[model samples]
Target: MELLLAVIPPLLCYVIFSLCKIGFQKRDQRCYMLSYQCHKAPEDQKLDTGSCADIVTRNKNLGIEEYRFLLRTMVSSGIGEETYCPKNVIDGREESATHMDAVSEMDGIIFQTLDKLFAKTGVSPSEIDIIVSSVSLFSPAPSLTARLINRYRMREDVKAFNLSGMGCSASVVAIDLVKQLFRTCKNSLAIVVSTESMGPNWYSGKDKSMMLSNILFRTGGCSMLLTNNRALKNKALLELTCSVRTHIGSIDEAYRSCIQVEDDLGHKGFRLTRDLPKAGAKALAMNLRVLLPKVLPPLEMLRYVITYYRNKIMKRSSPKGAGPGLDLKSGIDHFCVHPGGRAIIDEVGKSLALSDYDLEPARMALYRFGNTSSGGLWYVLGYMEAKKRLKKGDKILMISLGAGFKCNNCVWKVLKDLDDTNVWQDCIDHYPPSTIGNPFSAKFDWINDESMDFARREDYLPLLKKHSR
Candidate 1:
């Protein structure tokens, strides 16, 4: 048949592309699953401490500016509202709080979100065979993963480990690790948590060169479940087609572009000295080099072959960063870019050629919650769920960039209708409607006709001019 003949060549190209993913050097800069963590809190706020006495105790100790800024950002940002603070129960001093307590305050939110994720995945905590958590800050006795295993009191055979100091890219890098584990085993379940302890990591010093990272990053977390069994794959939550990682050399400038340290003013934090947009583009180019075989059909490649060559010769840099360098937009039905900052999201949107509608969730997440770092994607995903934009077989592409000059991504296809109208949804209704600058409205008073002035803000896409750097 004519249709059959037409499909064969494209299918063949996909098969070849799939094969190319088998081997790749893992590259991750710390985002979606990779980046930073939250602020520093005292003993009372550790996951083990669940007393109002504790949050209040610690809240009082927090600097006024810090508390005011965080409250404004997290409260107004449209990320889901939930057990804002989940703490561990130690000796019942605080009976039962949230997992927020036991999470060592490395930014307690990541794990709390994961608990909801567990419920969404429909996999019992007991059903999980492995627990792998990555957070750049915090160490807990009976690690956070162990607490989950204990809370479920599942089988004693569950494998658990905690990893930190790895950049934000660890989630996919961690998933890749789990993939190898499941490949060697059968019917095993792995839960990977990627979060950043950003609350404590915010840079607060006179080092103007390093403070940029702080301005961009916010607080958030993301979790993923991976399984190798074909049986499980049939009923899996999200089917990951594959993943790719690529890295540029991690030089001093790149390293210091986003470095963690205690500032001269005694404010210890992480900073960014990057023109990060450029770095992100470079990594994307490299990933595409390896990704060509998997998604591009030979016929599609034929169309691209000319286009690719034409760009190589015909144009260099336009006023807007334009003329075909990587079309991240078409490759994904939805995107959950890190709510790193307003500028970051704007740059990402412009570079990828995404429309305002396509970037609504990311901007809303930033406006709503500040940046929850590793958890940022989940908040954006929460927005998508509120809109019910996800359907089975819908493919979502996520990309994160961070410290090691790293970049990594995952492509997920929904296997079923995710019951997203959960706690986060209830929380979102509390905020003002978010739009282009105030996509999620500002909680405080706004000047008259502010939204009109705000419309001009939409044109603030920084990476619009190619070769501007």
Candidate 2:
């Protein structure tokens, strides 16, 4: 009887404690991006047409005509002079590419950024519940995720995922994975490390299609920390609302559009077919059809429904092309469209009916950092925050396209003022440059273009006023 009395009192105390913990704690399982940073390579590695030609000359497979094609592509690429490459390539040294070079690039980017993020958020590595690392070109023996785990000395039991070959959409895909994991494991923190290494992937071949990668891709990376802990609400910059992913790889043309291949001479390069932009558009449309209705306000959805029926009725009288436009801008305030290339950005902007101001961050990111693969979207977001255009309660949509002919979108609601103490600090002042484009350039006179009518232009101002409250 004495032993039963002792056990009953302790059991009652434990029940009371459990009840208090569950009742008082906030159980918002939504993930938040606490912080992120993008890597900046050295200045000497920045390549122009002449510098690219110098490297092309080293490859016996390329000729003068191919060199001229690269130069022409560069003219329309929207890439400026600040993007970077490896040290040996910039120094004109003939060092054989090694796994260490790619590992070094990943180390420099992943460790530095993760370090800063940890410091900014005051979250230790041991506290991290999951770590996801993604890279396209190089997947070594140990894996980048394993490297991060060892470097940070994270807990042995912490889950780690290493993603390879996912291309530029890999990071967002990682976020999707994290979201699902957080739904199951509450009060968890995850780190997403995004990077691409050009050391081994550099094309030494003459295939014009493959050579496009050399002209556009640059050295850049981003590391972001995500958490499901409600205690981190104040520190988080944005809250994840929804994520959508679409892959058109089942289509033969789309599957072949962006792929890594070996030329006849045995030189490896990533091949980009002409159908890439169309494939990207299709994938984006597919993803948005599923994603938009979930996030769009009721009025916006009704308007789209009305437009759809009106278009169906008009199809009898007009060309069958007068269908309902996506009208995404009506629901989203800021956009971080992947600056994959000038063509991709232009295609996405036109498809979404985005304004010049809406695309400024993407254009500026392309100009400043070139296409850093999955990392480019973060740079675009950084550009917007650096410009002080983002505000609390604003909604942001980030879109990325990858080699699988994949389109992924993540919708986020701003939680707090942006934390820009790292990546944007050095060059943010020079961005959205004073002289952007000429009268004939695509950037100019876009605001008044008839194509933008689908954005519901007249309602933009009123919508902003409504959101401001």
Candidate 3:
């Protein structure tokens, strides 16, 4: 009788303990996003075509060929005139950008974003248990997270992480980091700030490959509040479901595809080699290979497998120009692709066989904000919210490509129907404009005439001024 009593009690206790552990694990894994704020620089910082042309004309390093190349790239870049740049760039002092300039640029954006996010979420700085800040081009001595802690006077024991050189994919990577931390830290709140310092990293060199970034990247940032606290579920906007990251940096070509290096003349710049597109495509394929199985419906996976085998048996390749290789629509409701460039957005849309509606947020964001590096994805998300496309039970797939030849993807499930226009509020009505064509092409087509001496074209000033309006 005594032996039976002891054994039965211990066994029952063990089972209860195991069940409790499992429940706690599941709870810890649940991460919720409360709100996000995207920074919009003041109107004075906007870079229209006329201002860009004026800056180019003042640059002594650019020759006629370089001017024409910049014009061509700008026209085809899909970025609109209202995109913002660093104050230093606007002042025509990019080459002389100091550490203070970089710090000032980041301070303006990050502080404004964090302040707005705190106000939106009503979350005090003291409540933030962890901080993760990612800035690819500039890392200062105090560190960005430290700057936040100092400015906001956060908790003394809070965990802070600063990520540098991760490129445009850094935001997703930061989210992934927070997800992992949530698994260990019970009921914690995290803040993620994503931005790039454009002032110090501006390319002054004449290398065509290195100069593309000058036209594409602009000044922007975003701050997000994420929490694993179940008590705050009612206030959450999106729930983190799955995250996948693929890095192909082991390959030499991929590693060198996008790098910051000094040119032959010792002028530092970020070089985008011809191999970048190839590297991005490969990384994306590898990432999706792992992610699709996790998020796709079972029926979709089965159909894909059956199709593959049937194609093999028939000795035929899949039909040409088929909608995505697999029906991702069966799983994902919306796509928030990185607006790295027009080509990148188009390529992702084609590969996934996404409809024009699915790609509109990305295209519109690109036209509105240019590429804000890691912060760009939030702009796309904001556009979707402004358009009121996200609904409860909808799943959004976010894909981000960056240097280190990395592809990072994550899935978020909407908790509620969110309609905050955020940064796109001012111009949301004008978006998906009648046309996204660059007015620069029409006004500056005369620059392509090789017969004219661009350097000595003072006579063309009147024409430039007339068309600038």
Q: On a 0 to 100 scale, what is the lDDT of residue 306 in model 1?
A: 71
Off by over 4 Å in 3: 1-16, 453-469
Q: Pick the candidate with the highest lDDT.
A: 3
Model 2: per-residue lDDT, tens digit, 54-118?
56556655444554465557667888756777665666642367667667767877887888778
RMSD (Å) of each candidate, 1 decimal: 12.3, 12.0, 2.3
TM-score of 2: 0.84
Return the TM-score for each candidate structure.
0.66, 0.84, 0.95
Per-residue accuracy of model 3 over 195-264 as CA lDDT, tens digit each: 9999888888899999998989999989999999999999999999999999999999999999999988
Candidate 3 lDDT score relative to the true structure = 0.91
Candidates arranged by TM-score, highest first? 3, 2, 1
Compose the digit string of candidate 1's lDDT tens values, residues 10-38: 99999887766543212111111211122
**Once superposed on the true structure, which residue ranges of model 1 sit more than 4 Å away at CA?**
1-122, 198-219, 311-319, 323-331, 417-419, 427-469
Task: Tell me, by TM-score, which candidate is best.
Answer: 3
- TM-score pick, better of 1 and 2: 2
